[model samples]
Target chain A: MRPIRAKLTQLMIFGVLLSMLAGCSYLNPKPLKPWDRDVLARPEMQLDADSMEDLMDTKIYFSKEASRGGANIGGGGCGCN
Target chain B: MQLKQTGRLGPALAAATCTLLSGQGAQAAETEQVDVTSLQYREVDRVNVDEEVIALKRKGKDEKRFSLKLYHDTITGASPNGAYFPSDTYTSPSGSSYSSTLAPITDERYAVSADWEREDSRRQKTQYGLAYSIELDYDSLGANWSRSRDSQNRMRTYSYGYGFNYDVIHAEGGNPVGLAPATDTTRSNQDNKLLFDFLGGVSQVLNRQGVFQLNYGLSLSNGYLSDPYKFISIDNDAVVDNLLYEKRPDTRLGHSLYARVIYNIDDNVLKGSYRYYIDDWGILSHTLDMRYRYKLNNDFYLQPHFRHYSQRAADFYSIVFYDAPAASTYEYASADYRLGNLDSLTLGLQAGTRIGKRTDLSLRYEILRQTDRLGEFPSLNASILQLSFRYTAK
Candidate 1:
């Protein structure tokens, strides 16, 4: 039963991802031009502008909690866990 | 005189023009940056940590970048040893009385990592990284590789990555036998574990004011999953009868789905993210985070952040065993509160400003609280303070 549920969840996740990709054609009819990217280029708009702070937060949370990973990949290991 | 002027002047003019153009290109594409950060974390009547980090990055004109980071931290104080108190005192089977209390500990850690990335003219980027960390009784080495490509219009990005880690644990004193009594003398000096991680993601630019990303991550770990220093108490008629070292399954598999959105409204930026995590150990969790960067001016901003997390207990997690199982049965059990049902919340604020033409500084503070759903374990409160400085070379 657990294996079946796990498989179903995996399928659902992939299904959602596929639908999102397919819907992109209709959702993004007018893509922004290079000249219109001024706001997007700002430091505040970057996904990981403050890498150090993000690293610290990830480490701290990982030590105190059981659930980890999602934001990025591969940050070695620690005994604190 | 005219011949000499044409011969020398023409070549010199062309050469100077070429040098000027190349210099301008180099200036536009090359960058060097250094960042320093310090953090202090304190848990109410529990652990305290002091950490410092330094990072250096260099980007070349050929779209290649390299970065190195150094980390050091010191941890000290006492933490709950996974024993629960059902009464003021409990008599052991030998007619001895004892009281449960926190366990004192101190440790220091150092870690370093280096990463390199290269991007081609076709908008395909590849990255490689290596990391190592060491402590008094633990050591870890890791490596990772990733690649990403952008769509023709640069409106979408697809990425995938893989990582591997090898770790060795040499517990202080010795590694305790799993599920054995705390007083048992049998022990091993070392144990090891391995981890593998895989990630896939997509990022989309939704118009000029917003962006969205979705990611999926899978992780697998095997061997030595138990904490040697933690133990569980067996309750017998409201008295602590026995204490056994914690035990856990040797393997774990986890999956996570994460989504994030960033939008710019006027001059302010708003960021939000959600994550759903599940594991084979019967633990399921959800996390939600939100941040709003209110721009007071171009040089200064105040950001408020909030995060909430909730999780269900693992299958083998228990506060105390009413009926102790035989050690020969090889049953899996642990009293670690981190594996128990709980909810946590963090509230934080950050203030950042430009200190000089090529430098910036930021300060952040956060408060976190964790509540145990079973109420058998004590609640936890912690505070975090961090300061950072960044300098860019012109």
Candidate 2:
């Protein structure tokens, strides 16, 4: 029963991802021209503008919790846990 | 007249905007940056940590960049030893009995990482990184490589990466054999493990006001997965009768899916992300995080952040075993509270302002609380404070 549920959950996640990908084209029929990207070019719009903060948070949580990953990879493991 | 040259000015303006949007203008010059960050973490009556990190980055002409980071931290505290509460005498399998109590621990860790990246004319970027960390009893070395490609319109990006880590652990005193009597210490003091991680991700610009990202990660680890210092007690009518060292399966496989969305409205930004994680050890988790940046003025802003995380227990997690299962029969078990069902939440606020044309400074504070679902372990509370400074030279 657990295996089945796990598989279903994986499928659901993949389904959501695929649907979101498909919706992307529908949401923006035409990609914004270069002149129209002023808002997107803002410093706050960068995905990892707070890289240092995210790094600290990830390390703290990884040491205290059982679940990890999904932000970025390759930081390495520690014995703090 | 200047006003009559509108036709020529229009094309020139379009070209300049294109250069900026494509990131070509920023790479036209070389720049160096330095960042320093300090963090303090405290858990109520438990562990406390002070950490500092410094990073140096240089972006050269031709879209090449190099970065180096140095990290140092000190941890001191008392941690649960996985025994039942009330400190009762427990008999060992070898006909000896002893009482158990929490132990105080102190340690310091130092780590360093370096990374290099280069982007080509085709809008493809490749990155390579190496990292090493050392503690009093543990050491780790890791390396990774990743590549990302952007669509011609510069509105979409696809990325993939692979990472490898090797770790060595040397427990203080001596490592206890799994499921052996707590008094018996005949096991090897050193053990090692290896980890491999793979990730694939995509980022899309939904519109001028929003962007979205999705990532999937898989991790595989093997060898010596159990904590060497923890043990579980056998309960005889809720009183401790015997103690045995904890044991766990030597291999683990984990999967995670994450999605994030960022939107801007009137110069204020809102960001939210969700993550789902599952592992072969019967642990499942969900995480939700949100942050909103409110622009107070052109140079100062305040942001509030919230994160919630919940996880199911591992299959073999138990607080106390009524009857201790034999090693041959059970194969794996642990009493670590981290492997138990639990929920955690974090609330934080951050304020930042530009100190000068080339300097930025930010401060943040957060509080976190964790609750055990089975009500066996005590609730954990912690607070975090961080300050960051950055300077850029062009």
Candidate 3:
């Protein structure tokens, strides 16, 4: 992959160009509807999906790698790799 | 979960009728209503959050006079350190030494939070909050404070936190598995670290259903960052079975970015979010979360969610690692999953009915299943049930 700066620059340029070059658009923002929010508004549909699932996944992920940061802000006693 | 997840489709399709029956466009709101919503969650000793919020407005005004929320939670659960199937049987890239299976552990935790917010009709809003948490056994307490503002075209939020932590195994105790010289007792053993965190974000409402937010967070921590139970394994077959235990680097820096989007629908809403994370240890991660909510009617709904996560192992990661495997296997651990892949799915059902004109209750159930990227790794699944009752005397 290119450097981080390159990726950021590309995104900025894309956003600027997209804003300046919009012709007739069919994807305009629409009004909010109850039916549409039916799925998105549910608590079960929150970012983590299920806490139990996230907990299990977090344990698995933490044990398997050096990277750890997402839901919470701490680590605990562990002898595993 | 898959079957129930599939069953949810039936209601979603049935809810399609709502779009045709209801009028289009946002509905008008009534003036002067006091609305309060709250949830108290408990997870034994693993995780718990009690969040109660109340919003009050005058009889006929565009401004929200006041809002308050109080949260308290206690978390307790058995977290697995690492799992190993026999040496030949387990072939993870990182490698694990002990061909063993250990029972899970229950770590205790408690947390509390309170917040107040206000917004004048001018559309400007301000919010302030305070939070605290303590993890028993390991003996750690976390304190935090936050503030934010919001309006029409632009929104901004800023927050800061401080924490003090201590580990008994690190400072006072001798090497639990006394075997050799301890050059690395400093980072892994007993610890006192102060934590500082800061977050700043900007948000823009691109229309009704579309919103974009960007955030940057910096965290500085001292003390130990290693897992007392997490050990590394070395390849010397003899000592491999009896892995050594070691600590990880004490301090590190972390930075990340987050973005989310929601699309409005007549009866079905679509939402997606992504987060990118990186730290000093050369580990990078990306997470994508998507959910679709389907409304069956005014009293019913079904939702499905999917998630994908990936990350590389830490620099000192390994399956069969002996702390400082290269120098002297001081710690015992197999980096078997130190850097594993994760994929999950969730399906839920929500049904609500009113006991009277002013009291409403809802029942919800969700099933989640997770699998590791390494085809050989184990898979775990869970089921949860939620019951909520609300009473309003407007």
Q: Best-fitting candidate, measured by lDDT?
A: 1
Candidate 2, lDDT over the whole model:
0.82
TM-score of chain A of 3: 0.42
Which residues of candidate 3, in runs, are more than 4 Å off? Answer: A1-81, B1-79, B83-98, B118-124, B143-145, B150-190, B238-241, B322-370, B375-377, B384-394
Q: B249-318, model 3: which lDDT tens digit per residue? A: 5676766565666555674667776767766554567777666767777655665656666675555555
lDDT by residue (B30-82, candidate 2, tens digit) is: 87777878898999988888887767777877778877777777889888778
What are the clash counts of all predictions, listed in order?
0, 0, 65
For residues B150-216, could you state the per-residue lDDT of candidate 1 as single tens digits? 9888998889999999999899988898889989988889999999999998888988998998888
Error of 1 at A19 (Å): 4.6
If scored against the real structure, what TM-score would every candidate get?
0.89, 0.88, 0.61
Instruction: For each candidate in the order shown, give its overall lDDT on alpha carbons.
Output: 0.83, 0.82, 0.44
- Candidates' chain B TM-scores in the order shown: 0.89, 0.88, 0.65
Error of 1 at A71 (Å): 0.8
Give the C-alpha miss distance for residue B373 in model 1, angstroms.
Answer: 1.6
Q: What ranges in model 2 sit over 4 Å off?
A: A13-17, A20-28, B1-29, B86-101, B324-328
